[model samples]
Target: RTNDAVKTKDAFRNQAARLGFGTPNLLEATEYPLTRLTQNWQLLNSLYRSHWIIRRIIDVVPGDMLKNWIKITSQMPPDALKRFDSQVR
Candidate 1:
């Protein structure tokens, strides 16, 4: 059964941890593929939420100020954009 399989997997993980085979953090356990998938999913969900929040904040900005800000940013050099992107990330 699925439940038995999960229990067996957990038991193996616990035993491995007891023997110091891996980190105690379940999310960092690469032996389980689901952990990576879960981390990626969480990252994507966080990005989606951040994008939505930024859009809402942009909507609240005054039209003229927003336009001026966009124009200034558009005039920025590629290096400047890269630095800004890194800082944002």
Candidate 2:
């Protein structure tokens, strides 16, 4: 369990580095939820089928997670976040 978490953290760091975002700030956001959404077959099925309760979770979960991720990662040093923002332009 500990090992898996460490590996996940490393992977997220690499991913963030590639996108030129600050690594530290993205740690928590990348940990379980990101991995879970991609890897959980049951959850993915519900999301795809848009099951009633799952539909509500779909409407809120990813958007909320992404918003929180951006909020935290946007706190990068000096003008780092600005530069990252410009890249999306």
Candidate 3:
């Protein structure tokens, strides 16, 4: 929870074991952990961008999505925001 690396490692290992990789520990399951994190990041980033574009088009998106987007904006660290904004502009 809350960006805890140990939890991240454990979840990564467990998921990999389910997929039959049988990695015995975090070090062994390195790729599995990265794959899982990357997959989730892709999903969240895509949904965020897609809904953002759609909302601009129609001037509306669900209230919940808008709220979550606003919260996510603050959740992003300053360096991350600057890097992202640089790409945008």
Question: Can you tell me which runs of candidate 3 are displaced by over 4 Å?
Answer: 1-72
Question: Which residue pairs in candidate 3 have backbone atoms (N, alpha carbon, C) closer than 3 angstroms, thus clashing?
Answer: none
Off by over 4 Å in 2: 1-43, 68-80, 86-89
Q: What is the lDDT of residue 85 in candidate 2?
A: 64
- Model 2 scores a C-alpha lDDT of 0.61
The sequence of per-residue lDDT tens digits that candidate 2 reaches over residues 28-80 is 45755344456788878867686677777777877787674544344478588
C-alpha lDDT of residue 24 in model 3: 57
The residue pairs found clashing in candidate 1 are: none
lDDT of 3 by residue, 13-88 (tens): 3564554246455565566423454468677666667897744644454554555443235788899988886675
- Cα distance off (Å), candidate 2, residue 57: 1.1
Score candidate 1 by TM-score against the native.
0.19
**Candidate achieving the largest TM-score:** 2
- TM-score-based ranking, best first? 2, 1, 3
Question: Candidate 3: minimum summed lDDT over ten consecutive residues — where?
Answer: 5-14
Error of 3 at 6 (Å): 82
